[model samples]
Each structure stands twice: as C-alpha cells, then as structure tokens.
Target: MSFLFNTYALARPALFSLDAESAHELTLKSLQKAYDCSLTRGMMASRPELPASLMGLALRNPVGLAAGLDKNGAHIDALGNLGFGFVEVGTVTPLAQPGNPKPRMFRLPQKQALINRLGFNNLGLQAFIANVRKSQWRERGGILGLNIGKNAVTPIERAIDDYLLGLEGVYPHADYITVNISSPNTQNLRTLQGQDELTQLLQPLQEKRKALADRHGRHVPMAVKIAPDLSTGQVDIIADLLPRYGIDGVIATNTTLSRDAVKGLAHGEEAGGLSGPPVHELSLQVIARLREQLGASYPIIGVGGIVSGRQAKEKIDAGANAIQLYTGLIYRGPALIAECVQALKR
Candidate 1:
C-alpha cells in the first residue's frame, strides 16, 4: 500500500498524459509483469479480512472490483493481491470481437467521469476461462464473479445462446456468474431488460444452472446487471421478476446514458455509457427503489460512481449489501478499497 500510493502518485501524471485506453493497457501489462516476476507481491496491501456473507457466498469484505476493468480475466491474481474482497471479470461474449472502435473511451477529469462503448470486447469464453483457471484468487478464498454478455455480432433474439454458452464454460470456475444484460455499448443489449426479454433470457439459464449445480455438486449464485437509465416502473418490473427466475442477486447498474450530470464537461457528448461521480446518485436511486420493493430478502450489489469510502457507505445506506468499484479506482487508486472497507465495517 505504501509503495502503490507513493509510486502511483508519481506515475499518475505520466499515465494520465497518455490516451485512456493506452494507459489502461500499459497498467494491465505492468501489473501482470509485476505479479509474474514477484515485484508487486511484496508491496501488496495487508488488512484484516472483514468476512461477509452475501447471496450464500462468504466474502472477506464487502468491497469488490467490478466488471469492465478486466474484460478478459487476465488480471485476476494481480487485482486480487490489491485487497478486493471479490473480483468480477468480463462481460465476455461466447466469441471474440473487436468491440467499438478506438477513441471509444474518454476521461473527463473535471467531472471525474469516463464514457466508453467497449462493446464486450475480449478473447471469448474459452480464453477467459483459461485465464480464470490460472488465477490464485479462488485458492486465497477470494470470491471471483464472471460476467457474461452477448457478442456484438449476435442477434438480440439469439443472445440466449451466447449467455448459455458462457454459463456452461464458466460454471466450473466462477464463484458467481453475472448475466450482463445492461451494457449500453452493445446494440439492443439493454433491450434484454424488458419484461418478456428478461424472462426469456433468464429462464433457460436458471434451468441449466440447476442441472450444473447438481452435476458439479456446487450451486453457484447468478446475478443480473442492469442499467441506471431505467424508469421506476421498469426497475419495479425487474425487481418483481428476480425471485421468480431464481436470480441470486442484482447489480444496481452497468452505466448510464444520461448526460445530465456531466452536461458541460468534456466528452459528455460522447455516445456511450457514462460512469463515475455523475453516476453515484443515479445508481443509488435504483438501489433505494429496489430495496423498497424487495426488502432485505434479496441481495443488491451496488455500483457506479463510488470514488470514496463515504460514497460507498452511501450506497449501503441506500440498501446495497455490497459495493463494487471501477471508475473510482482510476481516480483514487488502491486506497479507495481500504477506505470503503473501513467505512462499511464500521
């Protein structure tokens, strides 16, 4: 922790000077190098593991690394060493695809936000599972959640095939599975949230999961990720249906398409999902609404725009059992994780 704060403070200026995507790629590569060579293993943060129970999975803490930061599961070990109670990787489609074109990611420092349309880009299901197999997080007792999505080329109606494929491939490895039906970057991907579409998408997956659990002798939980742009009625509809489908949890949001928060900031006009400070309140509203309808019986993984411990606590106050981070990590670094843990544990 001391090493990261000191070094990252010095290196942030240089990293921020590069394009967002390039900087991200460089960091991932560097983390991989450091972990493989044992350079960062010693520098990793050490904290009292604040054990928590959510959706039947026992976790070390409530703060988790959200999906999208590691689209391919390549950084599982490296990220796990940084002290997340859990790490979720991907939105990995059944097949590999290039995703949206470059310049698809942009940073708005002024608003503490990022906009991206990196449409489920990754090395596909097989590669993703292989990476997860190589990770040490599971051995260390860290919960690993694999998020699955449809490929850009897959038709909306046939999207179930991709998700089902992901379910079968990752079931043996994941601590939990995230069905990502909310990323706005993929065309009509958000449409899966609609009543009939969502039901159709989840029914088959849950049925298969029952068989998989019986075969593997492990019943891994499944969570659905949704967008923040939905209306109250729409959110209610989804909440009402979660229990019927046997979905174990719901991530309050993926990202928002609304520009209201970053209206005057640079890159606010970009045509993609927006995340960071601007999304904090929007995501909270969704969690609060879900909590109101579902009560404490269901679990909600709150995410979007949490950049500090206080902010993480706010999400819990709004009714999230656990919180995940992504955009905040870019702005605040590893320190945010401890801060969140402290706030939540207290």
Candidate 2:
C-alpha cells in the first residue's frame, strides 16, 4: 500500500504540472490503457471484504468511488477491482458536451481538496450506454449507480427532460440511479432544490421510477445527490420531500462552493465546488441534519473530506448508511479504502 502511495507521489509532480483539466483527461487515458492491458485487473484482483446492504442493494463494502472520477463510465471494471464496494459513473446529460473551458479544475494540496467546475463533461447517454455495454466492468458483480443530470445547454426549468431521458437510457444498466440537482457549475441547476420547484421536478421522475420497475420486473433505487452548501432550512425541506417523492436515499453532498478552509491558498479563488477536509465538518452537519429530519430510517451516503478511517467513522456515527471517497483517493491512494473499512469495523 505504501509503495503505491510512494509511486503516485513520484508521479504527482508531472501530473500537477499539466493544466488540471488536461491532466484529468490524460489520467483517464492512462487508466483506459491499463484496463486494456489487463494490468489493472492483475493489480486489483485481491479484493477486500467489507460487505454492506443499503437501499436493497448488497454492496461488497460500504466505501464507494463517488461520481466525477469516471464521468463517462469508461473505467467501471478497472475501478471496481480496486476494492470499492460500489462505483458511480457520470453526471451524464442527455447530450454530450465538452464541459466548461480550460483551467476549470484545481487542486488544493495543502487542504487535500479539489475544486472543479467541469460541468458534466461526458459522452452523452447513447455513447455512455454503448461504452457501458462494451465494458467488462459493468458485469463484474458489484453495485453500480448511474448518476444523471441535464446538459449544459439545457434550461434549468426543463432539466427534468434531460434527467428522464438519462433514466430511460441507463435504467436497465444501472443497479441504481442518482439524481444530481446540486452541482454548482451548471447555471441555476441548484434551484431545483427549492420546495416548489423540487416537488414539481421530482413528480415525473418518481412516476417514471414506478413505470420502469413495473416494465422491467426489477426495482432500482433512486437517490438524490445534494450539495453541502444548503442551510438547515433547505435540508429540512429536502428531508420532507425525499420520502414524499419516494426517493430512496440521499447522497449527503456534491461538493461546496465555499472556500472557508482553504481561503487565500493558491487555488482558493477557483470558481468550482471544493471537496476534501474543508467540507468534512459541513458534510457531517448535513448528514446529521438529514438524519434528524428523516429519522433513522432514511439512508444517507456521506462523502467529503474523508481521508482516514476515523473520518469515515465520524460520518457513520453522524448517520450514514455508507460513505464515498474521491479527493481522498487522489490524496491517499487505494489503501485508504481498506483502511477506512477496517476502521469502521472497530
């Protein structure tokens, strides 16, 4: 494990030297090569044991790889082998897009966080499904959630159309589906969280959820991925609406626009949501608040700034059915996943 970290650290300088967005693309390309060569399979085959059950899906572990890491579903099998209990791909829109302009993603090394305004840069629904169909990873026997959203050009008022389209396309392929209404980069996307708008937006999706279940003879849970920037009032509203709309669970955060913890740092002023240590406390606060509103029965997936076993446990204690990591993986490597699962067992 330490050797992996050492090797990654040795390569960090080279990766960091490139523009953030470009570096991301290069990393994905490298991962694709690794997958093609079966190197990732050989390296990640000795999987850990950390089974968990949430929302009727049996996860191999409680720690999952969050969305954004595999925005196009290209590396599902490769990532699944790396010991994640589950993997989520995409913030996929109905149509493909190039996302925001260059220099849209930044790293705050000192704070162990990432700030990215990479607006749903994906290969669109048809292309994404085609990749999923071709991948050996999707059939690897683990939990997979399809995270859906609107295209960058779609008007906020009509976001549901895109989400529904995404649901229709990926519903059969995904073990579950995540509705992402909280990403801050897309203009006015977060407005869907408002009481009136949210209620209206969710109604049709809920209806489709039922229709799909009946049509396919399979029940795929639907979860809402919310931002950590909301106030208690907003959280309360969400809590009230979740069960009312038949939403299955909540992914406690989707990153934060606040730069409180890394203020004045090199990438502090980057215009994107920040994730890592800065959002840990706030993520816990949101989970706890949601727990209060929804009570112990509601399922919550806690994510943000969880780089250690103790941090993972803090989220569980605050009321998370499971937890996820993205920036932490970037900072600590795959060993952190086993470490977190082991620590949670204690």
Relative to the unseen true structure, what is the C-alpha lDDT of residue 82 in candidate 2, on a scale of 0 to 100?
70
Number of clashes recorded per candidate? 0, 1
Error of 2 at 169 (Å): 0.9
Tens digit of per-residue lDDT, candidate 1, span 140-194: 7889999999889889999999999999999999999999999999999999999
lDDT of 1 at 225: 96
Worst 10 residues of 2 by lDDT: 39-48
> What is the Cα-based lDDT of residue 35 in candidate 2?
56
Q: How far off is residue 31 in model 1, in Å? A: 1.5
Each candidate: RMSD to true structure?
A: 1.0, 1.5
Q: What TM-score fits each model?
A: 0.98, 0.96
Error of 1 at 168 (Å): 0.7
Question: Candidate 1, after superposition: displacement of residue 282 in Å?
Answer: 0.4
